[model samples]
Target chain A: DVKVTQSSRYLVKRTGEKVFLECVQDMDHENMFWYRQDPGLGLRLIYFSYDVKMKEKGDIPEGYSVSREKKERFSLILESASTNQTSMYLCATTAGPYNEQFFGPGTRLTVL
Target chain B: AQSVTQPDIHITVSEGASLELRCNYSYGATPYLFWYVQSPGQGLQLLLKYFSGDTLVQGIKGFEAEFKRSQSSFNLRKPSVHWSDAAEYFCASGYFGNEKLTFGTGTRLTIIP
Candidate 1:
């Protein structure tokens, strides 16, 4: 079974604070993704990494950045958090573009 | 632009009753389809996927979905509903060999006693 784990399940931060959400996968997948989920909006992609140091912006990449220094870990960074940035963050990894993606448990961020 | 639509936002069913959730997609090419379930406060879990060969696909937790090419629909079903099955279900679609997926608004399933 594939396992994807996140650094935190819930977090609270003040406005203008820098926040980091980490994800690690044990399956050695080559593709990693970050998404923010909201009611009515569903899951919107923020960024994705196809390989180490290679990143691509998804539909909603504003206010967010990503780091993939290693194959097993992917990090999402909010350079300066705002109240509007509060959301349920999800991380996923897949072996390839066409393969099934396994997701982490998610991090619910609250930017006050 | 390619998109996924899940018409019903919420559905209620009694325990032991049969279940079905509707999904439709608009894409130019033959699409890769998927059904995912998200438990409260958890990440999305893959229920099933439809690539090409089989229109009828079975998934975890006694769930199944069928793909209809003419209607551009991929509907999920279950023979019996359990209280544990209550969750938000999402329908997603992507082009072949593309990692990006467009998801529907999701259907929140409520199981009645």
Candidate 2:
């Protein structure tokens, strides 16, 4: 079975503070993704990484960035957090395109 | 651009009752269809996927989905609903070999015991 783990299940941060959400996968997948889920809006992609040091912006990439220094780890960074940034962040990894994706539990971020 | 739509926002069903969730997609070519379930405060889990060959696909947790090319629909069905089946279900579509998937708003299911 594939396992995807997030660094934190919940987090709280003040406005203008920096926030980092980490995700790690044990399946050695080549594609990793970050998404924010909201009620009535579903899951919106924030960023995705196809390979180490290669990142692509998703539909809603504003106010967020990503880092993929290694194959197993992908990190989402909020340079300066704001209240509007509060959301349930999810991380997913897939071994190849057109394959099933494994997701982490998710990190619920609260930006006050 | 490909898109997915899940018409029902919320559904209520009694235990042991039949269940069906509707999903439709808009894409130029043959799209990759998937159904995912997410428990409260949890990440999304793949229930099933429809790429090719078999239009009807079976998934875990006693769930199944059928793809209709004529209607551009991939509806999920379950013979018997259980209380534990309550969760948010999403329909997603993607292009072949695409890295991103377009997801629907999701339907929240409530199972009555």
Candidate 3:
């Protein structure tokens, strides 16, 4: 079975603070993704990485960035957090562009 | 651009009852269809996917979906509803490779004992 693990399950931060959400996968997948889930909006992609050091923006990437220094780890960074940035963040890894993804539990972020 | 639609916002069914969730898609050609379930704070789990071959596909957790090319629909069905079946279900569609999936608003399901 594939396992995707997130660094934090829940987090709270103040406005203008820096926030980092980490994800790691044991499956050696080449593709990793970050998405923010919201009510009525469903899951909207924030960023995705196809390989180490290669990143692509998705539906929404404002105020957020990602890092993929290692193949097994992907990190989501909020340069400066804001209240509007509060959301449930999810990370997933796949074998390739067109493959089933294994997702981490998720991190519920709260910005105040 | 490809898009997906899950018409029903919420569906309720008693335990042991049959279940069905409607999903519709809009794409130029045959799209890759997927169904996922989310439980509370957990991430989405792949229940099934439709790429090629047979129109009907079976998934984990006792779920099955049939793809209708004529209607551009992939509706999920279950023979019996379990209490653990209560969760948010999403329908998604995309092309082969490098294409991002567009998800529906999702349908919240409730199981009555």
lDDT of 2 by residue, A3-77 (tens): 999999999999999999999999889999999998999999999999999999999999999999999999999
DockQ pick, better of 1 and 3: 1
lDDT (Cα, tens digit) per residue for candidate 1, span B1-113 = 88999999899999999999999999978898999999999999999998889889999999999999999999999999999999999999988678778889899999999
Is model 1 an incorrect, acceptable, medium or high docking prediction? medium
Write the residue-wise lDDT of candidate 3 on B1-113 in tens digits: 77789999999999999999999999988888899999977899999999899999999999999999999999999999899999999998888775467889899999998
lDDT of 3 by residue, A36-69 (tens): 9999888899999988999999999999999999
What TM-score does model 2 score on chain A?
0.97
Candidates, ranked, DockQ: 2, 1, 3
Give the least accurate 10-residue stretch of model 3 chain A, judged by summed lDDT: A94-103
| Cand 1, B chain, TM | 0.98
Candidate 3, which segments miss by more than 4 Å at Cα? none
Best-matching candidate per DockQ: 2
lDDT of each: 0.93, 0.93, 0.92
Instruction: Per model, state how many residue pairs clash.
Output: 0, 0, 0
Cα RMSD (Å) between model 3 and the true structure? 1.1
RMSD of each: 1.0, 0.8, 1.1
TM-score of chain B of each: 0.98, 0.98, 0.97
